[model samples]
Target: MTKCEISIKMMNSTTPSPSLGYLTAHQLENLVKEHHRSGWKSLHMEEAFHLFNKMLTAKPKPSIFTFNLLLIAISRMRNKQHYPTLLSFFNQMHQAGGINTDTHTYNILIDCCCRMNQVNMGFCVFSGMLKRGWSPNTVTFNTLIRGLCSKVDITDAIHLFEIMPKVGCTPNLITYNTLIKGLCDSQNTSLALEWHKKMVAQGIQLKPDLITYSTIIDGLCKEGATEKALELVQEMIDKRIAPNVFTYNTIINGFCRKGDIQSAFKLFEEMNEISITPDIVTFNTIINGCCKVGSFDKVSQTFKEMLARGLTPSVFTYSSMIDALCKGGAMDKAYEIFQQMVDTGIEPDSITYTSLIHGHSILGQWKKAFELFKEMVDRGLAPNTITYTAIMSSLCKEGKSSEVI
Candidate 1:
């Protein structure tokens, strides 16, 4: 379909002026062209539908060719809400002397229905298409399977997938990816793996993308199978599939959670050596790992090293440092770093202030701690439960329970 046949315009309903008299198809074509050139493709479904209705109603006993334009117009809309509108529009067009529905028209409607989460309507369209002797294509089956997978009804998705070959419809990469993602989301890792294996066995020439590997790795990590996650990472490397930043971060985080700080550090170094530069998350994980083991000195040193490497420390980095310092009774130094944070153009967020408050309170500086609390409130920073707990405990230590309450 040409752009001229799919122009969309927004009508000004407030201006009730001269009625548009009878319009020929030629005039409608010209108007569509005029709108199309003026960036009509960017209009949303609502705006386009309103304009299209005006064009259709102007012509009495509009041709089925007019409905074809409407179909393409709705496809340009690319939104699910327009599916029913398209269906109703086509029905009305045929009732008003429109031509018979063709295979192309039904395919367009089915595709739109599937996209809009109305897979049942797509099925209805499919049945209609079949009754009219219109054969289903690969696009039709993929759309339905994808729609079912999107709703997480894996049973229906698998059933649709199985029937595709019966109808001579070959599943593509998108079909595999959609089903794989659904299985991964449902935590059916074994089935997801089986599907992946089947795809390979079929000589599908599959390229396991980052999402595919990450989903499996993350699932294994959550199931307390860190070894399996690591093994997958190694396998991805062996398969020449370079891991992305997220993949490295996931494994690093998993290692940290398992208290294997050494493994996490090794991965961090290996990531950089492989030209996968560490992001803020990578540094934060290692810093947090050191903090968990009460390795304050290592945490401080690592913070400096990260800064020296020109990595702008994020809020989490500073907060982790404050946490490690306070836990190690280095409140004075922690306060110094807190001041540097504000001076370095990185605005101290609530976490930054809370950590300093906790540090001062632990050092028996109740007045200083309270002043910081007031500053936090004045600066519009909300103190969380942890901040309140730290301050209250410090107050109780100074025999100021009544004042604290």
Candidate 2:
């Protein structure tokens, strides 16, 4: 039989094929429902496909909802490599021609398409949904908008946002948040603010949520409008929205980038006051900020506090501390920290080695610097241009220019 003939036979088959194993449509649905309820973990792809084949050849075919459940499970697999497997299975179901596709089915397809970087295919699926007389819901619009945004097609995303109301679907908080993120990601924060204003003015009882505020704040911070971002944080609190750790981190990072370590510390204290524990990222940002300002004392204090709070120092934490000590002309202390980092099994990067080498070279300790360079190479870490320049410059300054070659 040809492919079409086999599909027709599969669609029309009443009795379950013995080769596919016997399972009633209702039993297969229960299996799928259980898998869905368990967070899509109980069913493997092969087992799901086996059940699907059994359902197809059963006396009564399963409902589209059941099929959608299986497809959702496949789509949501943690390993995204299963996305194409889902698309292929969807094609097989479509070719069989027994069950009609629904809006949820198309939405799943659209999401898979977008995730696969096939945004154009997602739009095609959207168009097909429309042609099938399926009214595109808010979820449909949100998914498409996100797809357009992921491709950096902000203009089209904005156009779609404008027409959402025309399709009898009002934009919700998710819709507003998605569009705002898109605008911000495209470096158009000014337009994002306008959308924020319009969302507030709509008076549809639709208020900007934490995500809405955070996205705009992050955009402003990226633009060096950190003071404005801080004002937004106040607005969030005034509106009875508690700023989470992520919100605080974004603002703190902004202050650090601006060299406003004092302001960053103030926010760090505020987080403690609000019962929001400062995470490792919070400590790292503060330590790095102190390093930049040459406030080695503050770095030491903060590093101790971070340990007191039971947070393990990351590689960045050690590197920043080591670099700061080296710059402070405290070679012994820097070496002590380096040894501590090694004892803790935190492998040093080229930055760490370069900092120590540069510090030793500054003191005209060329032998120690050379030993460090050799050790760095033995560790399979390549010395960068900064490393070479530090050694060569020190040799020239010591009137040992001949040894530089």
Candidate 3:
């Protein structure tokens, strides 16, 4: 498993030149490292196999270092496409020589298996590692924990975490973060908080990172614990840990959901005081809240201010605006905004078209409603069943049921 003291020029991407003669074992290992560092997707992947084949053909043979690099490179592949290739190469390494698998080798195999969602295979490898006296490291356990959490198997994830200390795998911050994220994702914010407290108690000197704080705050917000979420925000401030845009957005969105726009505005102004420019999510949350309250005046003000700050409205923004106008019976104004939405290259979705059509129908402008229906289809937007029903309802009210047929 020692690195051979041999160097070879690495290619960003090039075929192995035959005229260069058979590459030494070090050259093959170096090439694998280069392919890995440069991104496997960007390299001539077949060349890696070719080089490995050539490597196995050389005298003194490619050592475990060569295959280890190759395995690491294969692990970096984006998806399941190269999984077979990875396993094939791993098997080939053992057959090429009587070289025994090392801890790193087992670790790589277990990690790759878990990544491919082959957790059973990963566990099999884990068992073999244990039987072979290869003590599992924190990385080994962390990978398993992450894979389990990804599958939302929180019971097993927590179970595995509890056994870490017993197995000499001290749960690191990353391990705690994984558990916290899993709890939050499962919407068990109360449990997430308990874990957070436990993590803090164990590592007082290790301050909670921003991601940890944000996850807890977002979980609380989603649970409608706006007041408690605010308390956490204050705690972050007191600890001299600045709340980023996500933190502010979470709290602000929670307040908005509670229809506490005044408090939402207060935080909005505070973000500016701290020089934290609001992102699209921030503005969308506020705009959506205003739409819920039928506060067109406030919605317009926020929309204008967002534009003044050079923030372009996302699809959420435009839909909120059009819906608010339609609700208020401002069909003409809504139509104007709808045109502007497309003029600015923001295509209206079904909600946008439905709002405009409903507004026209409410205003008794049946001609305009039919025109919008035609335009919607012309734009290649598939009108959902509700949109079709809205138009039918309008025609029905106007005694045009025969025309509808």
lDDT of 1 by residue, 1-405 (tens): 001222223233443224344557667666555555664565556555655566556645344455565577667767665666777666655555535667667777777776877777678778868987888877777777777777788898899889988988888777787788778777877788888778667663666666778877876766667788888889888978889888888888888788787888888889879899888788888898888787767677778878887899877877777777876778877778777777787788888888878887778888777888888888999999978987887777888857654
RMSD of each: 7.4, 5.8, 6.6
> What's the lDDT for residue 132 in model 3?
76
Ten contiguous residues with the weakest lDDT in model 1: 1-10
lDDT of 1 at 404: 55
Q: lDDT scores for all predictions?
A: 0.74, 0.85, 0.80
Ranking by TM-score: 2, 3, 1
lDDT tens per residue, model 2, 1-405: 001111112222244444445668888888778778888766676676677777656667889999888888877775567776677677777777788889999999889878887788788778878898888889998999998999899988988988999989888999999999999999999999999998889774899989999999999999989999999999999989889999999999999889999999999999999999999999999999899888888998999999999999998999998888887889999889999999999999999999998998888888788788888989999999999998787777777757744
- Candidate 3 weakest lDDT stretch, 10 residues: 1-10
Q: Give the TM-scores of the predictions, in the order they appear.
A: 0.67, 0.86, 0.83
Residue 390, model 2: lDDT of 84
Q: 83 in model 2: Cα distance from truth in Å?
A: 1.1
Highest TM-score scorer: 2
Show where candidate 3 strays beyond 4 Å. 1-21, 35-66, 94-100, 105-109, 358-374, 382-405
Report how far off residue 267 is in candidate 3 (Å).
1.1
